[model samples]
Target: MQYDIEADWHLLNTCNYRCGYCFFTADTLGDKLQMHASPQQWQSAFDATDFTWLLHMTGGEPSIYPLFAELCEALTKRHFISMNSNLSRPLQSFVERVDPSRVSFINAGFHFEERERRSGNAVFLENARLLQSKGFPLLVSIVATPSALARFEEAADILAQAGIVPIPKILRGSYNGQRFPEAYTEPDRDRFRKFAALAQESYREMLNTSGHPSIDMFGDIHLLYGEPSFTGQLCEAGRRFVNIGPKGDVIRCGGPTVYGNVLAGTFKRAKRAKPCNTGGCIYFCQKYTSGPSGPQETRSGFFDWVADVIGTAKHPV
Candidate 1:
């Protein structure tokens, strides 16, 4: 029995589309970098810990990985397996390997920004339709841009007609240097609350394909680090979750620092240091403070893991 349960959402960098506002820098057009954990690498990660139940499998697009089905088979033996995808491929391919109950619904990243890319929406709808027909889980997740909210009614109608549920995500901009959105103001909050309530009531009759009846993975866990319930001044990434790259480099969490090659020694050489980068964490490393005036708090042990994981990021001057 594993002592502590940690959700390991691995990133196998195989992808298809190049979205403009991708969280991962390498997920852009110019930097076409793809790194996947080989069979040996995954074996090594599995051997490193005795986690009771493994979490889900995430990626740039899990379907793009040729060995995705094989990976699912191996994962089903030990953990609850789920994959996040853009729903650009055939559902039959995935059904051939994964079981419906064990798998969560697919998170269809709707390409609304690219209106001319008609196939984008078509493929997502097709995939959702196939999954729905087979009684498999299916969902639609869209990054709610300023433009999206303005046209939310039409979008919701389209998805509802296709027998899919839409999950609206709050899009936060780039890390450290980039500025946060100005539109996230008082009026927007009030409007959103009403919109969400109305949406829930209106779509109550629809059979949403995602995890939940409507939304699949709600809240900021996908963007923020740690569980929403985890609240404190620090986090325990090193002790809780170990993020290992293909080259055997261990980092506190998957963020900007990973590319810098901050090699903390292997898991066996776990040290006791504090992460200095805590002040400017870009990822959801901690929980969100509810009140406007409250000081933000994160999960426990975050600093301790960072201190032990690696050192400074040496950006080019």
Candidate 2:
């Protein structure tokens, strides 16, 4: 529930599934998986920072990372970890070796079409059930694309057979040569809302309290209407939360601000918040952007310094 810094770490891009709506292309997904460091090295780099970190590990499929269980095991020994995965890989090692308390959440992305094509529903459900049984905070979601929305009922039925209801993840990019959720018809929007509501009710406790940024169910709903811009808004992205690349380039949100590399032991945390210049993830934008401080702003005052941290970071993203 608490950590000094929460890193949005994009560990790798190799994946087993080729979901069309995914940002990664077939080549990117098929990219040969590689580990830039050992499990011990990654753990050591994180420990070098004097702060307790909540690492949000994501990828084309983080489960496919080399020595995944060992990496997670090592990291959780000193810091908390969260993840976004397709639930396709073996998880017995993860469930046994990693402590549930050291985990923030596991976003099980239910790629309905991909699972159906690969006949992987059984394994996916089995993994989800295992994680839930082990008391890990789990959230299941399905990307709401045109094809996905049309077959949502069938997908819901399939999930229902396993006692799972998936939240609808809105598409923010071009899908099948069409843009969406704009490309979605009114029927699509209506159907999406129904599932979104069901998903919200199922994980209300975690959704209301510590909604995972990767699967912000509420933010997904808001995105259903329209994407909001947060330019010039004061935000604490660099100071409290950071976006880390696969090779360990530390970025201040989606902007070009790089704070060295964590793996190379040169990363530095920003002293305070700054105005948001880049438009990126809607969850980060909405969570970190603050209400108007009004005009007549002066950064040289004591009140301004306190406001810099508390004004935007009081509510953890």
Candidate 3:
């Protein structure tokens, strides 16, 4: 009952906000047609999996999907359900319909620029409180842009007062002629260090003092403070982890090409971990399939066991 398979489905490319640093730009969104799998399609895909899977739904914003609540209701019955959302939309309806126990967690992104726009901070906080009150494991995260970092203390204070700890994520792209995961300026590096320190402290005080056992904090520290070389390591893509596009095509980890389609019930051979041949490897992509032993031997082992009990393969990648 070692449920080792993990899938991250890019449900759609339609987001309500335009965060300046987002890789998914208006032009990028324009190039791709917005689409979602029907509930039946979701069921078929779940049914077709030879191993149990922890299914993650992500997009421009998953809450905006037309049948979001219905889809959640269906998926929760068969597999663990987790979502990456902006939390700009109301969640009472979703909370009422989907069982909280089946939800692995919700990663809510708080865009500082979007605070003044639709579903402002007040509404976002209210929704978050509602979800937490109902016993949902909610991880509130914010991008650590310089501007966002300037106001982070205030935001952190507010969330801390309400029994919620905010996790600060390193901003992914570049700014002011500097690229990320490669060419961060001294000031940029300092800002991220300060943010991570604050987040670690807050996590200890407000959440669990022991921290997440499976997460390697040292690895995170190295990612920010030092250059990690994955240049020629065997990356376990297509075997234990994969990225499924909106149309159900599977990509090896975050690779550029589609290997197969899950809905077609055709799975390509699980490729052996190979030496990374790309120019640069981003942390997210590297973390997903980096080690030769695969996710089962690392951070996702707990979910693997949980999936065995629930009769599905579960892991988050």
Global fold similarity of model 2 (TM-score): 0.88
Poorly placed runs, candidate 3 (over 4 Å) = 30-33, 181-191, 204-220, 225-229, 269-272, 277-317
Residue 230 of model 1 has an lDDT of: 29
Tens digits of per-residue lDDT for model 2 on 126-183? 9988998998888788888878889988888888866787888888878878876667
| Cα error of candidate 2 at position 40, Å | 0.9
How does each model score on TM-score?
Answer: 0.64, 0.88, 0.79
Residue 158's lDDT in candidate 2: 82
- By descending TM-score, how would the candidates be arranged? 2, 3, 1
Candidate 1 is scored at a TM of 0.64
**What tens digits encode model 3's per-residue C-alpha lDDT throughout 1-317?**
12355567788888777777777877665444454568778777766775666567887788888778888888777676677888888988899988887776687887866675664787788889999899876777777666776788777776765666667666555754566544555676566666666556655532363234212231233344334444555665566666788878887655764568877777663756666544332433344544435633543442343345435432111
Clashes of each: 13, 0, 4
lDDT of each model, Cα atoms only?
Answer: 0.49, 0.79, 0.64
lDDT of 1 by residue, 148-210 (tens): 667766776767768555666655665344433434444544444445555444444443423
